[model samples]
Target: MTAPAAHAAPRIPAPPSAPADALVRLHLSESPYGPSPHALAAAHRAVDDTGTYPDPARTAPAQAVAELLGVRPDQVAVANGSDELVLLTALCLGDRQRPGVTTADTFPGYRICLENVGRGCREVPVDGIDALADAFDDAGVAYVCHPHNPTGGVLDRAAFDLLVERAAATGTPLVVDEAYLDFAPPGTPQVPDYLGTGAPVLGLRTFSKAHGLAGLRVGYAVGRADLVGRLRAVQGSMPFSVNRAAQAAAVAALADRGHLERVRRGNADARERFRADLAARGRRALPSVTNFLAVPVPDAARAERLLERDHGILVRDAGRFGLHGHLRVSVGKAADLARLLDALDIVAPVTGPGPGPALPTAATAQERP
Candidate 1:
């Protein structure tokens, strides 16, 4: 018999290219400053150890994060990113027979994760905490993306306290995603304080934002030791989920408080300036405590495309997150914001009828004392 015909190797498509130098990346909420010098040095050093397997326990990063948050290493579970932690939470805690509860307008990843695992998700309005409580009563998991994604609204301490109490009373798992909490003012309530309340709460954080390490993809979840243990068990299966370079960088980034503070201050200034510029141009920007501002536009999709194609500036169309006719623009460096503002001035004049009733502002919820 003739030799079998040579098999053709499947062609793998090339991954998408990174943003070009001229492309203003206000879409992803990435830090404009990039990683700290210490983190960069640590990452470079880690590159020399590429031949060895990374620590599966993620011990160094875990201990660093635990110390920073006043939690024990056993209460910390590191992952490839907080997104992975979110997925792990769903896989480990969600039940097909029950549902996951969350705000209708959220980061979208949580709903996607829950639904991907064959569980239903119930979404209530962001301000509908009572409805959320009722939904959580019957849910296998509850998620609240504090400093909520597109709108950037944060739930007050009282609201979070109530949620924690409900979680305790109902014996449900609560996931508080603080992906942008580092940008909020100091003294903002965080997840570590609730750990001793006998409630199953998982506080998810990422090094991507204030630490300027989005490219590294490192994050962690901290909570009760038993609950964290469960997450760690799931994380164990994905050995080296967080590579050595990322873990080292995250640890170094945590120690660089000056860098983080600079990011917070710079972002706060840029956010306020951007919002004010928009207001001066007869547009409304939803008050934000996070690094991005959500501004209502005539058409989100059209505005996003116009900015990219015409101005070489990229922005997220909040319609993807159920906030129609709004654009989520990241706070960039002063020069970058100047470029964006100029581009906005050019694009804003031509945009047609604006968005409907303004979404609720975070002013009521996130007002700094």
Candidate 2:
């Protein structure tokens, strides 16, 4: 018999390609207009001095952040990004025996850090503030993603007060991730107000969101001097993580208040318009106070794939944060939002009546940070 005919290997289909210029990245919540001109100039200038190592003490950036926040330099702990600060908080406060406490649908970085250190999270429902209070034992750290992640629902003032009071009573370390706080209304209460309350509170702020410096990877934590000192101790052994150029950019970014305001106003307008467009198409979006919104869809994962492959529009599937049937769309420029709306019109056509009022219900809740 002739040698067995050579078997043909099955071929896998290649994914559909999107046009290079048509790609609209609305997934990471980056600033559509990019960094301030002053920040860009400062970063470019600092590039000339890269031959030398950055200040191991991170003095200039720390002082800049402190000045902006009306706190002492000693109270600030600068890091690679807010994500690193989250990990540092977990490393300092998490206990392998006791699970960390956080909202079930909040940012996943804190929980991931805890798990990496042999700890787990005890997640409470987004609306279950009372349950969260009960879970606040002194054995582990508690993370509060203010204005919450995927869903963008902030704890009311009363709920926040309760959380702080309970944490203070239990002597639990509270890590408040305020990465998206800059997008909230002006004069909103920030973490610095609770500094001297005798509770170990670490308030995290980042240059990524409103500051438009995500690529620079700069963020800081503010707290009581003692708490900040603990984080410094943990970060001491590492080489200068925040680079010199990034430090310069962050300092300059903080000084450009006008740029920040413009970004905030533009985002607010675009976010409302995006929500209205979705509503007109029979989709519902949760109320948002940040640079993103979560809209419920028939199948979130499928929707994400379809948007990218067919329309060159990128969005996040909320399933990664334990949310089902929702997509997280970051607020971009007006043109970008228009593109998203046009794409949605095709991929997600309206069928029946539009969804009810934009309130977040159990079936379609998401949080943002």
Candidate 3:
């Protein structure tokens, strides 16, 4: 929402590819299963109304989101996607004089958005959450990706509690990007669990992952009424950001709990089978609660190129976002993973933690196009 020069997007590594329909898209953690039929019908119906402007307030989806989370409508703000919320929060949250902070070796969007807004970002290492918590004392805002993107790891209840306490103590805006939260198991500590505690915390949720609405790009935030108000107010700059189809689709998607449950169960089964297949080949992926796995490779950057270039299979090079030596592979359809497994054996082969470096982490961290 500023000058283009200040809002340049991050560069992602892309090799020339076969047509999208022909490629194995295990790169973006998109749902292989499509959206609920009800959602699809709603979106198509919405398309007919495209001649009219979308509801600037995003009413239907916001209320649906609030209901889903058991939060009041005033505490929800639906957006084009959580990415928009990230940029908006980076621009308008907390003490702007102070810089924002997020975990290093995590998502680049937090740093990118903060810097674009002229608010600098401080990054704590992936294993440095305690350090991240302490930094909140002075940070304008803080971000953590629960069931973290590439690693698919979730913070334990104790760690999440400490973060909530720190945010309350310092009054810093703590933003939890829960884009993949739908795939995480039950009892995973999330933003809503701490809302009643009166902490300045927010959770960014999306229909793109488990709900399979990535193409429609609908995401929302739920938190304190005040924080939600600020984000809602900020939407004036892009009032129709959430389009007719996306808003309609998201509401329909949220109502179909059965579809979401099926997706969760399917993904869990696929992820485990994929992990077992890797184990059978003497390769191991880090444990994950989300829908992707961080598979180690001798050289992540090189492996990324070879996978797509040689096999027309796309997997994220974790190094591009600072977590080196791993490929962030989405747990896609069974046939696709089988193909990727076959391809990886040739491209990155099983290189046990050799002399170089122990690949730093068992898990790495996701990104945009």
TM-score of each: 0.90, 0.89, 0.91
Local error of candidate 3 at 105, Å?
1.1
Ranking by lDDT: 3, 1, 2
TM-score of 3: 0.91
Location of the lowest summed lDDT over 10 successive residues in candidate 1: 1-10
Q: Assess candidate 1 and give its TM-score to the true structure.
A: 0.90
Point out the higher-scoring one by lDDT: 2 or 3: 3
**Over the stretch 113-222, how does candidate 3's per-residue lDDT look in tens digits?**
99999999998866546888989988999999887876777777777898999999999989999998888778778999999999999999888889899888889999
Stretches of model 1 off by over 4 angstroms after superposition = 1-21, 94-96, 350-357, 361-369
Q: lDDT (CA) for every model shown?
A: 0.82, 0.80, 0.84
| Deviation (Å) of 244 in candidate 2 | 0.5
Positional deviation of 5 in candidate 1, in angstroms? Answer: 57
C-alpha root-mean-square deviation, each candidate? 9.1, 12.0, 8.2
Summed backbone clashes in each candidate are: 0, 11, 1
Judging by TM-score against the true structure, name the best candidate: 3
